[model samples]
Target: MEAPPVTSMPVTGGAVNMMEYLLQGSVLDQALESLLHRLRGLSDNMDPETFTDHELVYLLKGQQGNPFILRARRSLSHPTSPWHLRYLGQPEVGDKSRHALVRNCVDVAASHSLPEFLNEMGFRMDHEFTANGHIFRKGVMKIVVSKLSRILVPGNTENTERLSLSYLVELSVLAPAGQDTVSEDMRSFAEQLKPLVHLEKIDPSKQRH
Candidate 1:
């Protein structure tokens, strides 16, 4: 089935300058259960929503070393939601705080034919993967426990293999620019997950080196 045409909505409060609060760490195979238990208690509701997503990361190479990244994702479980296209700009340098990294982000909603649209826009498929996870929400914060798998074949969502035994844990909150209080809330929630997984904001630039 073909989806509708792409549409964009104007975000309020200067979304272009929005700072994302994020904490990322890995959970060992043995500690997965303990982490889940702790999450269940901290989350608003008892049951967590499960989701499987197939994501394609596209890049436009430039003369400089840095490349522009565009991510397109579709939900495997919910067919109703439109495909999402997201661009998260390179993180700013010199800020090593665990609170969060500030970056420019643009999000667009498009039909399933987004791949063709991306190619038309000069983006090449760099890599693709599948992530299965459980999402827990607390106020404005979103916590996800995800396991990534490598896509065995391009454009074939079904063909995949587990990338690793450890699960990737992420804590993030998307808020309008200038909302400094969100960072403190994110840090407090992160502390609750302590020894099971140490969640800290990782520098994307440093990770590349």
Candidate 2:
């Protein structure tokens, strides 16, 4: 049987925002693949005795990396903290950043070197990290990505909140009772930065208003 002809046109119209298209696009497709691999491994863990120590680490991160879940102990012998825990304020912030660079390829996108493209879209490079000594920056955009990740739920929905764009806005990884709401405030700024996507945000407005 002959398949229907396919149009090569880019999806347009509707809310039709660039970020929305990207969110439901080839880029999203690739992100899903990495997330699936991570989840499949986690699922297999119900029978831990069947897997090797190395295989366990492959599914479960030790000390660092995966966000929703943290490696409690770096090794079977040594136990302290992942060092990054010094920064953990809540699970939402932690979940927001979890598997950030690992899936979104925001780290890979940072490598694109298109400051003008990013800026024209009202974005900037702030946070920088090196993979094999190559520096990459996400600036405040990283927080936006973290938020979008929450909204999108990607492959880690169990941890990432995905309840309508509005509801999730109220969702943040900060203490609810604090006289301060820095994490929620930062999420707001990062969301307004015009879609750079977060693994990251602003500091000044990041506190209680």
Candidate 3:
């Protein structure tokens, strides 16, 4: 799949400095067990929580192209929770050696009326899907192992089809921008996963081409 487009938006309150560092990689079927074992050993706590989420991707058309891509997501398991709205900007590249991605982002917790509000703003729902995963947290980093599936019918997340057999693994952290040291931490943590899955930044631009 092509990566989502990036756009700039004004920051509200303390979110001005908040930037997200991410590394994307995949786990083969045979290697999943080893990776899970390593994660259990590395985490501060014993158990990891699982989550199922359904996400809707929305796009706003502009004169040139689709200028804004918005992601609205809500948990499938927890019906009471509100939906989440997120916007991620272009990846920031620093010195040539870094493998972690830094991007400007905005995340909002929205009420049930979010879809109506977005429609009023002229955004159209483009696509939707579901992901089932186990999330492990270690200090500042979040490690997710998930499998994506396509929604067979709109607004009916229960009926879906698997997109692939391999699991998508992502290691990420959200921190204030200019915190270069966070990359080092991300690298070190990823190293522990080792041969099971080599987690590194996958440039979205490269993926597009």
Candidate 4:
């Protein structure tokens, strides 16, 4: 199903930065080609244990460069965003009011199905990147490019002929809520899990039926 606009607040954008242009022209332009190349290299060069979280974060941040993602903003970490956006299967934690509003928004949305859902028709996801605590600056959307079967692309990369995890990391350009960006993933993830997943105050496994 077609999703609704993330927020009702009007959007306004500012000027661009030198760094934004660098990422857009370089990595963003060759996202697909780069992704495919990296995927091809995985067989010989991939290392599971050596790969670290910072490296993963670096990979995620460095990879977005497709024409479509660039259309969302002049560049990643641009001075401003196009508008508010959302994603499925992210995590959320916050005040009751904000959490409730976000939770409700995701209720009508579908999960971001990737490689597993290749043959099956369903909803797709775009995880737009900006910044978070200690990560991004204000109003600057940092480009986080992920490979197939990874965080942005979730599934097994070894045997799948179809690279269904191939997609851009869709980010929210502008959001009305102050400090709201921090909770985007958590809120989105909780919203997705609201229907099928359950959470308990204490450990549920310790309880008796």
lDDT of 1 by residue, 1-209 (tens): 22221112333444365556677899977788888888989999857788999899999888899787889999988867899988775554344343765455667788988999989989999999999988889988989999999998777878899999999998888766567578788888888888788888777768776
Tens-digit per-residue lDDT, 89-125, candidate 3: 7686544565588787778899978889999999999
Q: TM-score per candidate, in order?
A: 0.85, 0.18, 0.89, 0.20
lDDT of 4 by residue, 14-72 (tens): 13110101111112333545433442332223232111111111111224662111111
* Number of colliding residue pairs in model 4: 19
* Cand. 2 Cα-lDDT: 0.23
Q: Write the per-residue lDDT of candidate 2 for residues 1-209, one digit (tens) a residue.
A: 32121122232322221110011101133353343333234232332221001001012223677433211111111123221111111211223332111111001112222333444544333322111100111222211111122312222223433222310111122111221334444444434432322324222224547
Say which candidate scores most in lDDT: 3
Candidate 1: global Cα-lDDT?
A: 0.79
Candidate 4's displacement at residue 14, Å, is: 28
Candidate 1 residue pairs in backbone clash = none
Shift in Å, residue 114, candidate 3? 1.4
Candidate 2 Cα misplacement greater than 4 A, ranges: 1-177, 198-209
Full candidate order by TM-score, most accurate first: 3, 1, 4, 2
